[model samples]
Target: MIDRVRRFNRTVTQRIGALNDAFLSSDRSLGQARLLWEIGPQGCDVRLLRSRLDLNSGYLSRLLRSLKDDGLVVVEQSGTDGRVRTAHLTDHGLTERAMLDRRSDDAAASILAPLSVRQRTQLITAMIEVERLLVASTVLVTACNPRHPDARSCLRAYFSELSHRFDGGFDPTRSISADEEELTPPAGLLLVASLHSEPVGCGAVKFHDDARAEIKRMWVAPTVRGLGLGRRLLADLEVHAAANRIRTLRLETNRALDEAIGLYRAVGYHEVLAFNDEPYADYWFEKTLDRSTAPAPNLPDREH
Candidate 1:
């Protein structure tokens, strides 16, 4: 597997002109070319560019300087906040970016030109898988205050999705809630998953003083589904629960979310008798995490 992956890496990098200092038959290296593309016509905040590209501060500064020296880009400090800097493309940079786009399209066409229709379909499918897995690998999950802007963004999306999917048109106020107070600090936590600085998923947990933890507000963006992010979020919540000395973990879900139910069952959650009166819940599940001595759930799974 390692050899296959390494050979694939070699083939793709060589085919993509990654080894060339003059990529796309241009004067700039691929790094410089990518910088221009990322800067785009609207420009970008320098710090954000660094995060999105995963570049070291010195390396990014050096690239910006090199582009500036070539008169291909401009970097300027914000008027209100001198500490903040933004990168904008010059006329030449825009032209260069356009040329790069054309060349990239040509390169893609060239790769497909040799393949039969079936091979092309297979190649495209494989490429999609590779891209999805790569993006999934880059996602970062962190515990944060539920009130943070990005956290709120994920919750808003979650609620909007629920409203559309629920038969009666869901209302947050009608359901059992994980309010801001419940998800803050010593009581509970909200975990937000980010991909290239954009929030992609979020999950929360409320503790009952080392006795149990209830998972809440769990969601992953539609664009990023089927990448196992939901499982990652669940495993992280389990870690948090264990750390908090929570012996059991529980969650309730609406019948509209079948995928979520499948995930819970796959990850060891078992249906139990109604433990809470959450209005929207059609199923309630729980898992006991006992380290030293505990039998797995072999008992028949009960459902409401």
Candidate 2:
């Protein structure tokens, strides 16, 4: 099994020209090439890079040092916070990156060069599936700021979905305000799942001064719904709450949100009296987060 997996990885790496030695051709490893691509034209936060790439601090630091030594990148402290750092590519670095881009294109073209038209189409289709699966695998659940672009995007999608699903047609303008700061750090939290460059799902937990938290605005995009994103989002939110010392979690949902209710039930949330005067809520749920047996529901994909 290990050999099969290793062989599969080798096949993919070879096909993608990952073994090439000109740096883009061979000298630098795939890691360095990917780092340069991620750096792009605008600089990126070092912390954000680490999270996005799912890299360990030591390994990421080593990669950054190598890029700096090669005169391809520079890292500087943030103007607003000395503790934060940003990375930007130098002129030479940009040129080198452009070459790498060209090489990648060439590599992809080489893969298609010998294939018949039908074979090319099949290959592209299979590649898309592989890409999506790989993307789904890489997505990590981490605490996030509610106001962060990805989180806001998820909320907007959530509201838009509610408007379509609800009898009255939901309106965020009329919806109760969700405090952004509450989702920032120690006090409360937001969890986001991103696949590639897009945010696919999110969940928020707002902690009271007591030990309880209100789970709010939980949502998964229609496109990615069936892949168990909702359960993952819920689990991540609970984990975030647990880390912050929150014991009880409560949530309210509209009657139209039957799937959510089912999810809550499957996850061991019990029916409870209304905790808030949510104009749209028809049911309320409360659960004491138990890491051992949280509900793991399989979310269905939304039909297009």
Candidate 3:
């Protein structure tokens, strides 16, 4: 499997001119070119560019310097402190980007030109699947305050989704409490899952004591649902619970959400009697973590 992956990488990169000093027939190397693209029309914060590309600060600084020297990009500090830096494309940079776009389209066309119609379709489909999985794996989950803007945004989306799905319609006030204070530290924690710096999902855990931790507000956006984010969030919450000496994890969900029910069961949760009188809950489930190791192996769900 390792050999296959290496072979695939070599072939794809070589064929795509990824190793070329001038990518897409542009003067800039692939890294610089990509940085320019990411800057976009509105520009981007220098700190964000470093993070999104996972580049070291020193290296990113050198790249930005090179672009500035070429007169294609400008880097300036904004705000009263003059500490926050941003990189913007100059007019020359916009013209260069347009050229790169054309070259990229032509390069892509060249790859398909040699292939038969059937082969072209198959290759494109396979590439799409690969891109989707890659994006999914790139998702980052971080613990944050439930009151943060991104966190609240995710919850709003989650509640809106629930209202659309639930037969009687969902109401946050009537639901079991997973309030801001409850999700704060010493009581519990809230996690936000982000893809490309945008929050895509969130999960919360409220610890009652050393023995029990209840998972709450677990949700993923519609666009990112099938990427196994739900399972990832559940596993992360379980890990957090275990770290806090929590032995048993429990959650309550509505019957209308078949996917949620299946996700709970797939991860070794056993259905139980009503643990709490959560108004929207039609089912309750529990799982005891090993504590000695990570969460249990994910059993294949029917949908997947």
Best by lDDT: 3
> Lowest summed-lDDT stretch of 10 residues in model 1?
295-304
Candidate 1 residue-wise lDDT, 137-206, digit = tens: 8888888788788889999999999999999888999898799889886899888888866889999999
Candidate 3 lDDT tens digits, 1-304: 8898799888988987643323535767878898888787788889889888899999999999999999889999865447879999999988887777777777778889999999999999999998888889898888878778888999899899999999989999999888889998879988888888799999999999659989999899988989999999889889888888889999999999999899999999999999889999999999998988875433221110
lDDT of 2 by residue, 11-91 (tens): 987766553543456467878887888888898889988988889988998999999999999999988899989999999
TM for every model, in the order presented, reads: 0.75, 0.56, 0.73
Candidates ranked, most accurate by lDDT first: 3, 1, 2
CA shift of 151, model 2, Å: 2.2
Ordered list by TM-score, greatest first: 1, 3, 2
C-alpha lDDT of all candidate models, in order: 0.85, 0.79, 0.86
Measured over all alpha carbons after superposition, the RMSD of each candidate to the real structure, in angstroms, is: 6.6, 9.0, 6.0
Residue 215 alpha-carbon offset, candidate 3, angstroms: 1.1
Runs with alpha carbons beyond 4 Å of true place in candidate 3: 1-6, 18-99, 295-304
